[model samples]
Target: MRAVAVTAFGEEPQLMDVPQPEAGPGEVLVRMAVAGLNPVDWRIADGMLKDAGPQSFPMVLGTDGAGEVVAVGTGVRRFTVGDAVFGRFWRPAKGGGSYADLAVAGEKDVAQAPRSVTYATSAAVPTAGTSAYNLIEETRAGEGKRVLVVGATGGVGTFATQLAAGRGAEVLATARTTKADLMRNLGSAATVDHTAGPVAEQVLAAHPEGVDILIDLVSGPEEFGAMTRAVRDGGTAVSTTGAADADALTEQNLRGFNFHNRPSPQLLEILAGQLDAGRLTVLVGSEVALEEAPEALQLSRTGRARGKTVIAL
Candidate 1:
């Protein structure tokens, strides 16, 4: 199998022929058509998960993908040969991932692909889509609520903006002027120009009362704290980057927590439904071949990619 992988942590990724993986117990072997590139994919290659667990060499990059099930291991019953699916395929300890000709995913991590979207789009959904959906559900952004989605031009932010707006929330997204129209089309009620000045200042200047919910996707502790100033008393603030200070927020009469994505087959099904029904749009900003994964990782590192990047297998 041809895969893009790293021989060691912090090493550059390269395309090489590797041993084909098989479906073990509770797994499903997928002939991947496309793989989604997330920041974590490169982070893992850079040793982000080193403290979490053991890792294997030649670790293939990527977690999310869309493909057809070619075989199923024992105990897997929901899918069979020829069924199309999409979801997580990350297993670092085993040197397995989605950026390959064939990948093995836990049966519980995958679901049927959306019929209305292409394989590239479906490949882009598992990580970013699930994170966005979970964030909106946790914040309960809906009618009468004001939600602020920082880094709203990114993949997760794009979906979060739409999901919050679909529920009637007044969504305020932080984006550059060039992306204002795109943000608005994704259901943002207002677009804050982050490049103009401080994001919190601009937001507070517009909504003096402050927003009810805050979703910070691209801030560190310092900037995330500043953003929370735009959250009203008794409002909720969440960070996907582990930047939330729960104790400090509690003292200020605000709810705060760090959000880590927990995507399930069920959640994937729900997201697929949204896509199939045209309520959600998967933004595939760039597409690359499997061999170009190293360049894609470099692009992700520069933080220049606008939306999701999909790798065709």
Candidate 2:
């Protein structure tokens, strides 16, 4: 099997021949049609999870993908050969991932891909969508709440903006001036030009009264703390990038936490249903073949990608 993997943590990923993975108990073997790229893909390849999770050399590096099930391990009854499925695929303990011709996933993180969605779209859903959903769930954002999404043009930010809007929150999204229309189309009530200066100042100017919830995606601890000032008294602030100052925010009587997403099949199904019902959209900015993924990943690391990038097999 052909896979893109790093020989060791912090090593460059290369196209190399590796042994194909097979289904184990409660797992399904998938013939990947497409793989989705996320920041974590490169982060893990660079050994971001060295202490937090298992690590292996020659480790494949994709976490989300869509494909056909070619075989199922014993006790797996929900899927069989030829079933179209998609979901999170990386398991550091296993060391294998979806950046290959074939991958394996446990039943808990796998779900049937609806026919209404393309393999490319399905491949893009798991990580960003689930993370967005989890963030919204934790905040309990909804009607009348004023919500702000920083870094609103990336994959997870795009989904978070839409989901926050769908939940009836008045959404303010941060993006470069060029993406103003895109943010508006995604249901943001207002768009802040993050590149101009401090986003908190821009947002504060618009909503004189602080927002009910703040979701910051691209800030460090200091910047995130400064941004939390825009959260109204008793409001909530969460950072998906592990930048929240929880103790300080708590002392100030505001809720704050760093978010970590836990993906599951049920969440994927709910997101897929929204896509099917025309309530959700997955914005894929580009598609490349497996051989071109390395370059695409490099380009994406610039942190300016406007939408999801999928690697078509």
Candidate 3:
């Protein structure tokens, strides 16, 4: 099997021939049709989890993919051979991952892919979509609330905008001028030009009263703090990048937390169903082949990919 992998931390990812992985107890072997690229792929390659868990050398990259089940390990009952599935496939403490022709995942990590979208689009859903879903849950956003989604043009931001809008929250999305239309179409009531000037001033000029919830996707501690200024008193501010300041938020009597995605088979199924029912959309900006994954991964790390990038097998 050919996969994009790194032989050691901080090494460049490469297309290499590796041994095929098989289903173990409670695992399902999938013949991968497509894999989704996320920023964490490069981060993991750079040793982001070196102290968090065990790791195998020559580790394959990627975490989300869509494919058909080729086989199932003993005691797995949720899926059988030939079932079409999609979900996060990274196993940090073990070896192997989704960036390959074949991958293995626990039965609890995958769900059937929706028929409305292609495998490549399905591949883009697991990580970003699930993160967006969880963020919305944490916000508890709904009618009459005003939500600001920073980095609205990125993968999770795109879905977060749609989900928040669908919940009847007035959404303000931050993006470059080129992506303002895309953000509006995803249900933002307004779009702020983050590249032109300070986003907080632009947002305040438009709303004046501050927003009910702030979802920051691309900021570090300092910038995330600046963004939090736009959140109304007693409101919530969340960052998926671990950039939220807990003490600062508490001092201000506001709720704030860094969000880390915890994916489940149930959430994947719900998100897939929403896409299939035409209630949610997954924007795939580009598709690359397996051999092109290394360059694609590099582009993702630069944070310049306009939207989700998928690797089709």
- Predicted structure 2, TM vs. truth: 0.97
Residue 218 in model 1: lDDT:
92
Off by over 4 Å in 1: none
Which of 2 and 3 is the better model by lDDT? 3
Candidates 2 and 3, the one with greater TM-score: 3
Superposed on all Cα atoms, model 3 deviates from the true structure by an RMSD in Å of 0.9
After the best TM-score superposition of candidate 3, give how far the Cα of residue 64 lies from its true spot, in angstroms: 0.3
CA lDDT of each prediction against the hidden true structure: 0.93, 0.88, 0.91
Candidate 3 error regions (>4 Å) = none
Q: What are the per-residue Cα lDDT tens digits for candidate 1 across 118-213?
A: 999999999999999999989898999999999899989999999999999999998899999999999999999988999888988988999999
- Ten-residue segment with the worst summed lDDT in candidate 3? 88-97
How high is the lDDT of residue 303 in model 2? 84
* Candidate 3 per-residue C-alpha lDDT over 231-313 given as tens digits, one digit per residue, 9 for 90 to 100: 99999999988998799999987899999898899999999999999999889999999999999988988888978999998
Candidate 2 lDDT, 1-313, residue by residue in tens? 8888888888888888888887899999999999999988888877788898666567888989999999999999899899999998876666668989999999888898967979999999899999999999999978999998988899999999999999899999988878999999999998989889888888888878889999998888999998987888999999988998778999989998999998888999998888888888899999988888788778877887759999987
Extract clashing residue pairs from model 1.
Answer: none
